[model samples]
Target: MTDPDPQPWLRLDPRMLLVHPAREVVRFLPVLVGILVAGGASGAGPWGLLGVGIPVALGLVRYLTTSYRITGGRVELRRGLVQRHLLSAAIDRVRTVDLTATLAHRVLGLATVVIGTGSVAADADEQLELDGLPREQAAALRVQLLQSGAAAADDAALPSGTPPVPVVRFAPRWLWYAPFTSGGLVAAGALIGVLSQTTELFAVRIDVTEDDLSALTGLAVLGGAVALVALVVLLAVAGYWVVNAGFSLTHDGGAWHVRRGLLTTRETSLDETRVAGVTRGEPAALRLAHGARLSAIVTGLARSGESGAVLVPPAPRDTVADAASVVLGTPAPMTAPLRAHGPEATRRRYVRALAGSAPVVLVLVGAVVAGASPALLVVAALAIGAALALAWDRARSLGHTLVEQFVVARSGSLRRRRDALATGHVIGWTFRDTWFQRRVGLVTVDATTAGGQGRITVPDVRVGDAIELADAATPGLVAPFLRLGSDA
Candidate 1:
């Protein structure tokens, strides 16, 4: 079917004029104050005002100069004082439109509309965000954009029939045990800070006579042992709670919107076609709890801010699969049971964990030298135990699947996890083996997705199998000669 014709543009509500010139002014006040205070203290005199005043004035001017108009067919933004700027994009190019209101804006009945378009203008793909718009006006503008021809392309691509919106999902409230469990660590850190400061100021010293040492050692043994166990229990619970907050995946209109976060709520939406990958994560303890988290990598959305990916914490495994199907445009394949790798692979992961604990080991060693007795050996043993537990967890969490156009990896203990990436989204691929891995015929496969840092590395796969998996996931990455070799 042919696409609908574009409509003519219309002016936005005059209330759009409320976008305060002072809002930007207020934003920079803290920095301006810091500069002013430092300069005046340093005897920069009125010269300090010159540094502060110019930038604030320039910012105010820029803010005042900015204006936006949402037409039936296009959105236009005009800004700049001395130099004029007019940015316009067809309503058809608009990819996604978002509405946001801070507490102040909510009180003022104003909202901001951030419109994302494929075309870039003035160094950004966000067409024109109309801030300080009346709530109705913002809603009307959103409706206009959604009804426009551009939205038709999005609607046509979505799966037919609306999916149910989750009214109640895993929220932070379900995990209050997290704070108490983790609160002591924060308290302990604060106590350490206080003690360190006291020591620096007063040069306090503990002199242990033989009898005093015996008593103090007994007390230390009791306190340290209790604190260590409490800290571990708290940390595990806190991690679980954090992994469970703000879990929601909703199908709104023609796109999937995932809202998650604990302290700061994050909402991300993407067209079905743009989803490049989906990942699930679970901790060992979470596995027993029958909870898993889901994450997705999608295209078209901004990589920065809260728009990059969808994070669902502590979702049931079935829920994760449902969300993945909605977001990734295909049913999530069943994950294979995790199997232990070769002995060398297991040893490598364990040794790596041990290497990471060097600093903690050194601290314990230092405590022994400081006449704290060799009791720190308990701490070292606990640390080693935690490391081994994590290694065992990883071994239990290892599994992968090759789907039609995606490669899926599932890992995590207590909390189980999975990641699915489309072959086409594989921007870069690499196979790496250290000298030791080479001798053992083991390798790692890494793939780069569109958003975020750090490559996704599946470490310790068999060398030949790793190459074959990489080729299956990203046929373009394999050489033509390799294609013949594979067929042969």
Candidate 2:
């Protein structure tokens, strides 16, 4: 027997040519320059016309060449010219399908749909990218691929299907977390870079010089720095509002829909079955400010990027808890009272923190005594005190518990984190024992998974107790390798 022919591929939209040129003009700057030179050298003759016509003519060729298909069993993409590229992946291997759009694409009613396989490589070759699809069509494709799972492949060619129920939506008040998100510094720097690039690209000149800096006094410089920092904070707050203004999360038809962004307007969906766990991020600043965020631990999302499909962004703790419970069908465990590790753990943490701060203390004190900046002494002392206090707080935060179908782990002090993970979704168990940890009879048990941060670590627990907790969380998942009475 032989495999049957695949379904016909859907041709790419002609608008793709426009979208490509809009985003990729920088890539083809050399081509544009060549055409300009040809035009200037040859005037309005055949060469000038050819020079003006090359981009549009070639863009149409490439646009017509590109196409994609969603067969019953596989997703395929074919594009390229002198060196053609083709991609095909079994529908079952599809781990995630994200719909992304920049401001331009949103205006054009287009989106880029990315299909990911649960691989760790940065290149993500196993993924297929379908660029410039109508937004509605992309959403339908996501539903079809996810509903099929990897176990089977069948085209459920249908309409956009039913929408999900709204679980959470951002309020204008949530913008309070924006400045604290990065203290506004990052957003400010990004805006400055963009402005610089734009002006230099267009050959514009600013009305400032080194003479301006030379004219400023010490107090003036300090004032400038303060002003710049404030500006940055404002930019960050505005950026947050722009991106998360209408953010919402909802559930329907066995998947989670994440819709957010103002100018770019993105719609990302995740298969409910693929949710490995949920994470609660409660930074000290944000927590004190009465804010928290919730994230779903799903397969093939960004492993190291900030805000990688966060389920809830900067909301009250209660709101985040409610949203998590509703969307994940778990208890949320946001209010799980942590059980602290013993005094020995706290002692170890204190000693480590003090030891780490010793060098800085010595250097700064010595510098002040040796007639360097006396202000350094105060800064160093404050830093050491903060570190010591943070270590104590971190020790208090080290706690974990297995609550029915969830394993709750809490750790950190500067920025506290609480993980509520589904026991069954845990792929493996790793017991980490350092020389210090072994001497103290403490171990860190990390529950490995295919999504989120890749693992949820239960730190600073008694060795025997750790094993029991892991075992109870997922029976037989951690028992086989343990020998309680002897070191196995």
Candidate 3:
């Protein structure tokens, strides 16, 4: 067998000339503005021209120099302005192909094609991105890359009567859980930070006089607080709605296809064979609301913030469970009752929780004893109550279970997560125990794999149970060491 001849180098869509410069300009706009403002204030004009000229020059250089092509069973990219560099990956190694279009790209009918082989190396070699291609071409290229090499051979064609099944779709009710998650708060903080930076640069003023607060009555103040809370919730819900608008997760052609976003659209295809596990996350607020978030544990895929790896946004726990079942090919591991770590683990959780809040509790108690306001006593009581609640939650969250070929670990209080990993994908095992854990005969077992976060930890399990779990997950891997120990 012989590899095909190399294909001719292909340039990015010429339309990128328009998009790239605009992007570069926006990226360096602050510097450009500073240069212009300084030059005007200092009675010099040349610096302003230089600032404006550099980004445009770089954009032009990038558009002219960047080129890529598929050939000889490899996807190759040659891109550099000052230093020539080449990056290539075997077609069989490709794990994901993502197509994205910003508002600008959409307007110009172009998309950025990102080809990922799931490299966890330095960021520079993580993926090959062609900034702009005609939307149709980008889509075609995504298909070609995903359906090439071993992927094509492994990808069985859909049955004649079977169509792609939609596992999850964005729903209006899901937005209710959005506000409970930290998404709104984070977005609000980021928006404020950007506005602060840009407004300060422009000497913009946002006036809120002390007189305004002084004039408010008790009812008015209460109403204002309520309004502020409502605003934050609204912001969070709106942000999630826009970013996840039209979101859908579907399985077809031996890949998981995720389509999402509104103003800046994205489509990602992930090879099903690379999926190793599924994570069901329930943040404190989301859990109270009975909602969960789902994401795939895929080999070599870097966790892209928010948009990356996620199969379903915050939705009903049932919905998340259904999605996880679809991805994992089984529901028992996800839905079955987890095996608790027993009384010792529960005691540890309470001790840790109380220890964390002890300092504040002591401070408040001392204040009340020193003739301070009796309100300090109430605060101390509240602190103790909160710690107890947290301890109970954490204890409840600690559990691990094994079902068939999947090993499930669930833990954490504030951000509880249940990870169901395929034992077949388990590559290694790690056992860790602190002095306290050793005293209690509890060990934390880490199931290391090539997928997801690379390790799934089942914390505070009995030493015997941890060893048994490890041995069960991968037969004979742990038993030999145990036999040696027994013989010794």
lDDT of 3: 0.86
Can you write out model 3's per-residue Cα lDDT over 364-390, one digit (the tens) per residue? 888888989998888888898999999
Leading candidate by TM-score: 3
Listed in order, each prediction's TM-score against the native is: 0.65, 0.86, 0.90
**Model 2 per-residue lDDT tens digits across residues 52-104:** 46666667767877788877577788877876778877777776677888887
Using lDDT, give the best candidate's number.
3
lDDT computed for candidate 1? 0.61
Residue clash pairs of candidate 3: none
Candidate 1 ranges beyond 4 A from true positions: 1-64, 69-75, 82-96, 116-128, 136-164, 167-248, 259-267, 283-291, 300-308, 311-321, 329-331, 334-341, 358-372, 411-417, 452-455, 474-488
Q: Which window of ten consecutive residues has the lowest lDDT sum in model 2?
A: 151-160
Look at candidate 1 and tell me the lDDT of residue 376.
Answer: 91
Per-residue lDDT value at 373 in model 2: 85
Better of 1 and 3 by TM-score: 3
Candidate 2 — what's its lDDT? 0.77
